[model samples]
Target: MSALRVNNLAISLDGFATGDGQSLEAPFGHAGERLHEWYVSTRFFHAQDGLPGGTLGVDNAFAEQHEQGFGAEIMGAGKFGPPNWQDDPDWKGWWGPNPPFHTPVFVVTHRPRPSIEMDGGTTYHFVDAAPSEVLEQARQAADGADVRLGGGPTVVREFLTAGLVDYMHVAQVPILLGRGVRLWDGLESLEDAFDIEVVSSPSGVTHLTFVAKPR
Candidate 1:
């Protein structure tokens, strides 16, 4: 069976995963690049940006894992676009023509639309189904590989709430967003289900891995 995983999700010291007022103009919102400073300087990140070089450290090691095994992606409507994006017929998504996800992408949204096949191997299929339903579709699309739970906090929370997540890696940044979307909302005692290991990097961000224990 393919494992469901959340990779490289950054959170604030206060536990906010993403700031408020998400839009095309401010994808990371008021939090800006504060949460992603760690990975942004990694060689893995520079490679994604089509740059020549960047730091090769513990951060880079973790960053590389995000792209290693996943065969398909599942993300929230918020991660797809800003508010009212569904109304824009011309919106192709935040990643432009060639998205980083070079695989089938199942977008979780209330308003379904026709599938979009991007320049890369990415194909966006919008669905209004629950986590389990979408996972079923993505599992078939993954073709025996792992499934990535790409998120914008709200969506991650939903899947975590549904107990569908098998593994997760969260980078706890130093900054604190006083108010914003939180990943752990209503998920009390969630650690009870997983075995967590913490590793701090020289970049000042702490990496946390949550591996789901046998049920």
Candidate 2:
């Protein structure tokens, strides 16, 4: 069946999904880019952005799997672009012309904007609806395929806390940001059940996949 999956979400050693003070200069927060070192060095990311070349190994394999696993993607306002709201309606996104995600993308934002058409099949839909409502719309857009939760911490936390996420893949990096946006911030309790089905890639990056068991 269709599942709400979070694939290749990076987290720091300190459990921070994003560093503090997110802006255009620091997209993933101050030191958040460090968490995604594994991804940026992979051939999957290079090929996605039409780069020349990159390494091919376990990192590449994981990157490829993560990229291909999702039919549609959901991002929070913070992940899509700058945190501050703008009055202008023409701001497309951080991606200038083409974005990496060539599939339907639903962005959860308080401000409403018309759907953006990119060079590839990628289209960004700004939804002012609640998280559950947006997820339903994303499911429809996914066409029976898995929906990926791509985010800026808050979104993932929401889905997790709501018990909507079926599976999650976290790439734990070795670095630590003392103060930043944490991944497990809003979780009500540590007793919540999540079964770790797979854990591997201990060398370059630590990959862990967990399946949320029904309570």
User: For this target, which candidate reaches the highest TM-score against the unseen true structure?
Assistant: 1
The count of residue-pair clashes in candidate 1 stands at 0
Q: Return the clash pairs for model 1, or none.
A: none
Worst 10 residues of 1 by lDDT: 20-29
- Quote each prediction's TM-score: 0.97, 0.89
lDDT of 1 by residue, 1-215 (tens): 79999999999999998897777898878888889988889999999889988889878888998988889999999889988899998787999899999999999999889999998799999999989999999999999999999998999999998889999999999887998898888999999999999999888899999999898
For model 2, what is the alpha-carbon lDDT of residue 63? Answer: 78
Compared with the true structure, all predictions reach lDDT values of 0.91, 0.81
Model 2 poorest ten-residue lDDT run: 196-205
Candidate 2 per-residue C-alpha lDDT over 63-168 given as tens digits, one digit per residue, 9 for 90 to 100: 7877665778999888888777455566788887888778899989888788988977789999998778999999999999889898768899988877788888
